[model samples]
Target: MLQFINPLLHKVIQSISPCVLCGIDRQQHHSLCRDCWQQLPWSKSMVQRQEIDIQVACHYDYPIDRIIQKFKYEQHLHFQNLLAGALLQLRLPKIQAIVPMPISNERLVERGYNQSLVLAKMMAKALNIPIWQPITRLQQHSQKGLSRLERIDNIEQQFQINSTSKLRYRRVLILDDVVTTGSSIYALKQKLEELGCQKIYAACVASAEI
Candidate 1:
């Protein structure tokens, strides 16, 4: 009976944490206020990412853009549930695990968390799938300032698969916060492909069309 209260306590603690999107007492909407809850984007569209099939949940505009800025730069993590809900709009493919694009150690330390990882966990919970952390960033650099070509070039060799990670699954879903040139996700996807990950699907909150 020692662990019986554990679930109760967890539920209580979660109940008290106010909604991040609207700062309300609404617990039913995954810590999002009813207004913000209704604003969720629910569109599934195919993305143009070379030969690999990609899907995006939203158009990367307005409130999502603003909230994503706060979520990343402002260190607001409570929006994870909201972001996860946004990602659920995508038409999921058959995959065993949801893999988040990893951030460099320096970025993780500076941010105190990896936004992609947070989103991945939320996605996994919503999708009823497992989370895999196979992709590792070997370099410590921000992709925001880099141009498309530079991002493509710089991302090369910056990511490598963790040999210890059990990635025997044939299909996997990749998650990212924002996609610009699709370079970073591409890099991680390539590494997974080399490791025998045959079918890959990717999802992101926002995609920049150039």
Candidate 2:
């Protein structure tokens, strides 16, 4: 009884406590104060016109980095809600499924969970879209300093389509925590295309560029 009461009492106290990111009274469902949120650099708009339309969650810098680090490394699952809310700001097109990039089994064991998957799940729930886990990883290794051809070559035959027939003609929105050189998502795009997904879009929480 005391243990339960103590935790509840502490939560009540925290409810009124000042926000860590911004010096303001904390509010439910708000991790940082409005000032902090506004200060953080996010894409002015989610949509970026490209061959394949993509939706970006936010720019990868400062406060966003801090949040992602906490969410991924520290296992701060509560950040999912905050991230999902931030993601909703993006004016993404209607998506049939949210596809998360799958990590290798070795990395998954080390991390104990996939951050992209959690982000995708939250986004799917918020958007009322199905979360697709049919994508399977084909290869794993450090991609540093690899040429464009080398990177593409490395991933060839690495990812396998779980069931292209089932997902044929459905729109796929691929989610990733970060994008560098667009290699990772490129591989996913090829795999998704092989699965016969009609319309495919990529969404990354952060990109290496502004």
Q: Using alpha carbons, what is the TM-score of model 1?
A: 0.81
**On residues 57-98, what C-alpha lDDT tens digit does candidate 2 reach at each position?**
677888888888898888888677667767777777777888
Report the backbone clash tally of model 1: 0
Q: Give lDDT: candidate 2, residue 135.
A: 75
Q: Tell me which residue pairs clash in candidate 1.
A: none
Which model scores highest in lDDT? 1
> What is candidate 2's local distance difference test score?
0.74
Compared with the true structure, model 2 gives a TM-score of 0.81
Q: What does candidate 1's lDDT look like per residue over 53-131, in tens digits?
A: 5687776777788888899989887678778877876678888998888988988888889998898887787778899
Give the range of the ten consecutive residues with the poorest summed lDDT in model 1.
Answer: 25-34
